[model samples]
Target chain A: AQSVAQPEDQVNVAEGNPLTVKCTYSVSGNPYLFWYVQYPNRGLQFLLKYITGDNLVKGSYGFEAEFNKSQTSFHLKKPSALVSDSALYFCAVRDSVSGTYKYIFGTGTRLKVLA
Target chain B: EAEVAQSPRYKITEKSQAVAFWCDPISGHATLYWYRQILGQGPELLVQFQDESVVDDSQLPKDRFSAERLKGVDSTLKIQPAELGDSAMYLCASSLGLERINEQFFGPGTRLTVL
Candidate 1:
């Protein structure tokens, strides 16, 4: 079974401080990790994806994620938090080895950047 | 920027009523996906289409939910005799190719409320 875990229900960070949203996964084959962001009532926006090569991947809105294979983790990060960056973040994983295109997503983590 | 499009950004319906949502993928994107997202959770794939053909519908509730991409340019999802549990945000996304390695572009979702 392919599954993703976002342990934190909410993450609060002070403005201008770095932020991290944790994510971990379990899958049968190699994992393709992705991150997305959603604002109130809107659909998700793609952040970044880790298919191969670099362990650290950068994406939209000054966000990036690091794919750690041994740890089975892909954590979203930001160099500096902004109030506008506050939103719901989700982590998803696709198992290439399983030959399935469907992605399994974790329960979201709400990011609140204090102004 | 080209983006996926969806209709009826908000809908409120009574239980047992029928409802439908429409989506148009980004131009030149061959793969389309429909997802159901419950609040506080991640979006789950309901169906996937490659052009005019259905690639996957395993997660869709066949008893009531049905989806089609008649010409492969746009698609529609219909649900008959809706239940309270069916209330959720229906998101539509599209990607560039068949390999499923490309990042997906999402639309503003349709928010459904079943009474």
Candidate 2:
């Protein structure tokens, strides 16, 4: 089974401070990892994806992710946080082994960027 | 930016009543998906469509939930006899369905509140 885990239910950080949201995964084969952000009353927006690239991948809104295969982790990070960055973050893994192209998402972590 | 469209941004209904949500995916996207997102949780895949055919629906509660994308352009998800547990956000997404690019584009989502 392919699954992702986001251990934190909420993470608070002050504006201009660096932020990190933890994510780990379990997969039978090579994992396709992705990060998504959801604002209140809105759908999720894709942040970044890690397939088979340089471990560090940059994404929209100055966000990035570091893919660590040995640790089975793909953590989302930002150099500096902004009040508008507050939202729900999710980590997902694509189950290609099942040949269904289905995404298995984590429980989600609410990010509160305080100004 | 071509964005997906969803109707009835908010819906409130009593239990046992029928409710339906609609989605229009981005133009030229071949794959579509429906997801249910509960508060404080990540979105769960309910159904996926490749054109007008159903590709996967293992997680869907077929006893009361149904989805269709007859023309492959727009889709609809219907829940009969809605239950309090059914209160959630219905999210629709679409992808190019190509092997290399699997990132999905999502709609704003429909929020349902079942009393």
Candidate 3:
């Protein structure tokens, strides 16, 4: 079974400060990891993904994530926080061995960026 | 940018009532997905369609939930005899195809409130 875990239920950060939302995965083989953000009453928006390339991947809205193979972690990070970035974030993973395209998501982590 | 479209942004119904939601994926996309998102949780895939064929529906409650993508363009998800637990946000997303890393574009989602 492929599953993702977000250790924090919420993460608070001040404007202009760096922020990180932790995520880890459990899978039998290689994993495809992704991050998505959802605002209130809205659908989720794709952030970034790690398939098989560099450890650090850049995404839209000035956000990025670091993929750590040894840690089995893909933590989303931003150089500087913005009030508009406050939203619910999710971490997802897909197992390569199963040949399944289904993305198993974490519970979610509410990000509150303070101005 | 092209976006997935969904109908009935909000729906309120009583237990055992019938409800339906529609979705139109971005042009040229071949895969469509329906997800259920409960409050404080990430979206869970209810069904996935490759064109007009059902690719996955392992988590879908087959007894009450049914989905169709007749023409391979637009899709609809229907639920009969809805339960209180069915009160959730129904999200529709689309991807180009089944790849190692396919980005899924999301719709605004339909919020269902079962009374």
Candidate 4:
């Protein structure tokens, strides 16, 4: 079975400051990790993904994530946060060896970019 | 700027009523997914379709919930005699399926309230 964990229920960051949202996962095989953001009353938007090769992956809206194999973690980071960045963030993982496209998602982390 | 489309942005229905949601994937997307998201939680996959065939429906409540991707283009999800617990957001996502690295594009989602 595959699963994801987002330890933080909420993260508050000042606008223009750095922001980080942590995520971890457990899977039977290699993992394909992804990050998504959702605004209130809207659907989720893809931020970035880590399949292979790169430990650091850049995404849209100036967001990026670092994949740590030893820690089984993929933490989302943004150098300069914006007010518009406040939203619900989710971390997801899929087992690369399972031959299944099913994605397991974390409970989610609420990010608040305070001005 | 092709995007997945979902119908009925909001729906409020009485308990025991029947409800349905629709989605249209991007022009060339080969994989479609339906997910249910409760408040303060990540989206959970209800079903997945590869083209017009069902790839996975193990998580779906087959007793009351049914889904289909008829022409490999559009899909529908139906819930009969909806219960109060059924109130949540229904999200539709699609992926190109051309490569394992393709990101899924999501719809705005339909917020359902079974009162």
Top-DockQ candidate index: 3
Q: What level of docking quality does candidate 1 show?
A: medium
What pairs collide in candidate 3?
none
Cα lDDT, model 2, residue A109 = 95
Q: What tens digits encode model 1's per-residue C-alpha lDDT throughout B5-101? A: 9998999999999999999999999999999999888898999899988878899999999999999899999999899999999999998866858
Per-residue lDDT of model 2, residues B3-111, tens digit only: 9999989999999999999999999898999999988888999999988989899999999999999998899999998999999999999998835457888999999
Candidate 3 stretches greater than 4 Å from native: none
Native contacts present in candidate 1, fraction: 0.74
- lDDT per residue as tens, model 1, A1-115: 8889999999999999999999999988678889999999888988999989999999999999999999999999999999999999999987566555777789999999999
Candidates' DockQ values?
0.77, 0.77, 0.82, 0.74
Question: Cα miss at B13, model 4 (Å)?
Answer: 0.7
Q: Is the docking of candidate 4 incorrect, acceptable, medium or high quality?
A: medium
Report the C-alpha lDDT of model 2 over A1-115, residue by residue, as the tens digit. Answer: 8999999999999999999999999999888999999988888899999989699999999999999999999999999999999999999999888878888899999999998
DockQ of 3: 0.82
* Tens-place lDDT digits, model 3, residues B1-115: 8999999999999999999999999999999999999999989999999889998899999999999999999999999999999999999999998773688899999999999
Candidate 4 C-alpha lDDT tens digits along B1-115:
9888999999999999999999999998998999999988999999989899887888999999999988899999999989999999999999987346677899999999999
Candidate 1 local distance difference test against the native:
0.92
Please tell me which model should have the higher DockQ, number 2 or number 4.
Answer: 2
Model 1 misplacement above 4 A: none
